[model samples]
Every structure is written in C-alpha cells, then in structure tokens.
Target: MEKCRFHEVKVSAPSKVILFGEHAVVYGMTAVAASLDLRTRMRIKPHKSRILVNFPDVGLKESWSPEQLKTLFQHKPNTEILDVNYVYLDLIHNFLKTESSDLRMASVICFLYLYSLIMDEVGIVPMEILVESEIPLGAGLGSSAALSVCLSAGLIGVLHQVQGYEKSIFEYTSSSIQKEVCGFAFLSEKILHGTPSGIDNSISTYGGMCRFEKGNLEPVRLERNLRILLINTNTFRNTKDLVERVGEKRVKYPDIVKPILESIHAISEQFLTSIQEYNQDLNEKKFYKILEDLMDTNQSLLTGLGVSHPTLDDVCRTLKKLGIVGKLTGAGGGGFALAVLPPSISGKTVLVAKDLLETKGYTCYQADIGVNGYVIEVVK
Candidate 1:
C-alpha cells in the first residue's frame, strides 16, 4: 500500500425519531422523522496492514486483512443485483464465525460490506475505525442507521483524501455528498434489514426534519427546534419482524388495516400542517392541543395494527396523567417513546415526569429534535 497521506477523520451522525407514521409508512403512508441530539460517532485513520473495526456499543471488535477481504471480493455476486446477495452474505456470516443472528453481527456485516465496496473505489487502504454512540441499540432510535451514516461519511472522507482533495466532503449545503452518503447508508440498512423505509438513513444523513413517503423525501422546516423527552422502555425489538407482522395483518385484513394506515397518513399530514402553522403564528397552546390529539390518535391506530407494546402503552398512559402526550417512535414494538415538550412547559413538570418514570424502571433522556445530521472533522 502507498504511504498514508491524510490525517484521521472523525464523523458523527445523529439518531432519528419517527414522530409519526411507523409501520404504516411501509405501506406508502407518509412518515415524519427528525434528528435527535443523540448521535453515533466514528474515527477512521490509516493503519499498517489490516483493517480494524471496533464498536464497543454492541460489543463488536473484529479485524480483517486486505488479502482475506480481497479473496472474499473475488466471490462477489453479480453487479446487476438490486438486493443483498445472500451467497455473499452467507460467506460473510461464515467468516465472522457466528451462526446466531443479532445486531452485533449485523453491524460487522454492514461495516465489511461498506468498507470493501467503498475502498474498492478509492483503492484499498489499511485503516482502523472505532465507533462510539450515545444512541441505544435496537431502541427504535435509528442507532443502526446512525452507525451506517457515520461509517459511510468517514469512508468517503478518506476517499476524498486518497483522490488528492484537501477540503472536507461534508458541508451544510452540499447536496451531492449528502445524497451519496444517504445512498450508501440506505444500502447498509437494507443489508441489516431485508426491507427498510429508508427514512432512518435519510434523516441521519440530511438531519433537521423530513417528510418521507413512497421513497420520496421533502425537507420540513421548524421556526424553532422542538424539545423532546425520549423514554427508553428497555425492551429491544426486531424491526424486521415488527414490519413483517404488520404486513401479515395487512394481507389478512386489508379492509381493516388499510383504513388504519390511511388514517395514520392523514394524521402525519395534519401534524405537518399544524407544525408549519405554529411556525408561522407561534401559537403554543393551539399547536400543543392539536399535537396531543394527533399523538393519541396515532398511538391508537398503531395499537390497532398490533405494533404497540404494553410497555409503550404504559409510558403513554403515564404521560397522559401528567397532561403530556407521547407516542412510540421507529418500528414501535417496544423500544423508545417520545414526548414533545411544549415550549411553555415548565422544567419542574419535566423533572417530575422524569423522576416518576425513572422510579418505575424506565430510562429518560432530554434532547432536542431536528438537530444537525452528519458532521465531519479532520483529526490532527
């Protein structure tokens, strides 16, 4: 390999919350996703001979030699393929020395697949990558998508250096790099999840807020960023399974499920409009009323779809007693629920709610919504 030519690159991508429309989004309904303050960070720099990956959050620490990965690349499936090549994935599973399926294994596979393909474009360079995250894994907070976006941005940053570029690839207004990052991250999401709505990767890449429907994304603007209380139920879920279950329900009772999905879609549309109106008029009371009603209705619709868990319901019900309304985010089996704190809400009220929930064995995080998406810095 040629001599290392650039300093290390550090990248971070924020976690996401699906404010409205979870499972129904899979059926072409619109979903609203916003970036949370929580994020996954990665540091990547040149190494001597082997490629190293360390992700302590999920307890994944593995290294691969260039030659071994090169051998695996030789068996790569057809370039015309649209989905993951199961043969190649099986080979990766065998190489990883694990038969059980889990997020840790999924992380490793996503890393290897992305690293190999991206490196092949800019030429192989021995590198070491270490990932640390504040986002909880499998908590419906877009943890995996954040990791994928961080890695994609970090690797592409390296690619820029290898091509003799001097400036960072990510800027607030750069659309091409943003699209590339989203594209790579979306592919990684597909590998981990057989089918994903692509909202997670898109939100992690673009940041701020977006309205996603049927593979199309439109940016949503807020006059002021929203404050949210993220509640982790401590119950992990399989997003793919939850999505599949919803699919089965739709197939079994389209009449029943289709209307529910359409209602959720209407809720998302109304929620978007209400937020925009609030942005224009700054009517906290009116907006909160509409938001609360929408949240309650959306949760009921999700419950009808059989995606809401007991823990999720408990969280919402508890919040309701305190005059706060919340709903499940992401895939919605049992992961995280979010409460949009009104701008006029008192700190004492929030603390009281947090204390009450923490006492009941739930975790709570105070975070801002619609924060910056992916960011990159040069490591000196």
Candidate 2:
C-alpha cells in the first residue's frame, strides 16, 4: 500500500433504534437495538491543500487550510472529547462571528481526529467533506454515532486505499472492516455521549439486531425482517443529560430505582427469549403479543424513571388505542417513539397509521429494522 490520490469515496452509517432497554442499559441491563434505514451520509474527495466540510443539515459550511486544523489539533491535544462535545464543538467554536452548532462541532472534531490519526501514516491531499443526514438531530436515533461511523468508515476506506492495503484480505472478511469502523465510532461516541454504552456505535456499524448486555454484544438472528413506524415527538433531548439523570436517581433511591432497573432488564431478557421463539417457530401472532407486552412494560418502567414526556405519552396512548403496541425508544425526555408493525399488517393499514400520527403534528418514518450497517463505496 502506498500513498496516491484516490478519486473519491462515499460512506454511510444507519441510525439505530432501541427495541428494548434504554436508560437501564447503563446499569448492566441487556438492550436490544437495530439499525434504521435512515442514515447519515458522507462523501470525501481529494483537494489541493485544505479541507472543506459542509453540513447542510445544520447550516454549517466551512473551509480551512490544513494548517488551521493542525493548529486546532495542537491547541489542546489532551483536551477530552467530552470537553469538545460540551462546549467547543468545532475549530470555530470560539471564532468570532460564527454561529454555534454542537453537532457541527462534533462532526468537525471527528473529521479532524480521524484524519489526523490516519494521516500520520500517509499524508492526504486536502479533501472536500460533505455530510447530510436523514436522521433527526436530537432524536436518540444514533445520529451522532452514525455520523461518527460514517466519518470513520470514510477515513478508513480512504486510508486503506491510500495505503494500498490489501483489498483481497478485507474482501474475504468484512467484519474486520466493521470492527475497525466500530472502534472509531466508539471513540467518536465519547465526544457525543460522554461515557457511551457502546451499543449505538455497535448497532450502527454492524447494521442489524444485537443483544448488548453488560459490555458484551452478540448478534440476534431474526427469521423475518421487522418494520417499525418511527414517530418523532418533535421533541429534543440530550442522551448525556438523560443518562446522567438516571444515574443520579439510582444513587439517590437505590432501593426503589435498583428494582425498577432490574425489572427493565427482565423485560429485555424476556423479549430476547420471545424473539428466539419467534425466529425458531415463525409464529407471528405469538411474537407480536410478546413484543406488545414487553414494549408496554418497558415504557412503564421508563416513565417510572421520569424520562417520559407528555408528547411521548400521547404517542404511546394513540398507538395503544389503535391496538398497536408502541414505546419511547431513546433517552425519552422527549425524542422519538416507535410502533413495531405486525408482520401481517397491510400497506393500507400502515399508511393510515402514519397519516393519523402525522396529523397530530408528529413526523413519521416507515423504516425496516435490522438492516445492513455501515457501508463504503469508491467512485471509480
């Protein structure tokens, strides 16, 4: 492998949905999560001697000579990512006359960090980086993880090409590719969620159903693909804040909160068994019932923890009234809720459900879960 100007590379990572377990996952509870079709897409191209980053999703557009990014890199090399995530998110975070966007900063940090880390081995020409995402900004749908994964995949993909890393070896074992991407995404997750649980990065990088428990992750094989109606409460919530709040509560009310946390873990455990049953037997009715019951339980536990919002409640109630099971999917102060569609559901039924939910001033996306994860393509 040798350094050479590669024409272009495109990479994308899917947003993730938590099928079961949320705040509880932090406390050794197993959580089930899947990747969504919605994704953050990034494209990179060689430029002469500077870097250009465009994020239309957040109204951020900036170009800097390599020296500028290098200066920022040296400004505080050991400054923790949490510091960058919390306050200074971009090279321009303190620059005069620049608008503030934390997402913009985080994305910029990942780009610079990964570029610098890999570019040490081989110098890269200035590059054009364009980032756009279909995933909502603050919705707990793994937006930050996805962004980080995309950048990681993009940089690594380009790195491999520039180094002329053997494609034949990477060709036979793509998991190796995902493993590298996941590692970088996890580091990026630290910038986004502070002490991230690692599930979001894993799910987004692998792009499928995973049972993540107590720091160990294993894949779950489902016989049939699942469709979920992702409804945004149009609510904004921060994962770090919600996670910290739950931690505070646990310490404050150990007896009460501990049991509840265990109960939530039980729900995930039960759901895992039910999924095995469904996959083993292809019993849609049985699995749907289990999912409905488990989601209801999960939602109640989350509400008990004080994370549920009025909008989240309304969404859940609406779905329950229609005999559709639903629950809050993420940090849940208010962000997104999900209704897993039964395998027998018809297109008309789904459309009606989406319309009814949309009429309530909510945004709805119909996406299949457990899809493929991060991907890279070179434009020859």
TM-score, every prediction:
0.89, 0.86
Encode model 2's per-residue lDDT on 1-380: one tens digit a residue: 23557658887889989888788888777888888999899998988777888988888777888666666555433423322343334543554233444545667766666666555566545788999999987667888999988888888777777777777222533767777778878877886666877888898888879998889889998767888999998877877788898899999999999998899889988988888888787578878888888898889999999999999999988877777888998789888899999878788877777788889999999888999888778888
Compute the lDDT of residue 10 as modeled in candidate 2: 82
lDDT (Cα, 0-100) at 348 in candidate 1? 92
- After superposing candidate 1 on the true structure, give the runs of residues whose Cα lies further than 4 Å from its correct spot: 1-3, 75-83, 100-102, 166-173, 236-259, 304-306
- In the order shown, the candidates' Cα RMSDs to the true structure are 2.9, 3.8
TM-score of 2: 0.86
Model 2, residue 178: distance off in Å is 2.4
The parts of candidate 2 lying over 4 Å away from their true place are: 1-3, 67-103, 168-173, 238-257
> 1-380 in candidate 1: lDDT tens per residue?
24445679999999988899787778788999899999999999888898899988767788888888888777665433435777888888888877637656888888877776766655567889999999877777888999999988998888777776545484333787888888889888999877887878988998999999888889999777889999998888888899899899889999999999999999999999998898898578888889989999999999999989999999998998888999998788888888999988899999999998898899999999999989998776
Residue pairs in clash, model 1? none
Candidate lDDT scores, in order, read 0.85, 0.79
| True-structure RMSD for candidate 2 | 3.8
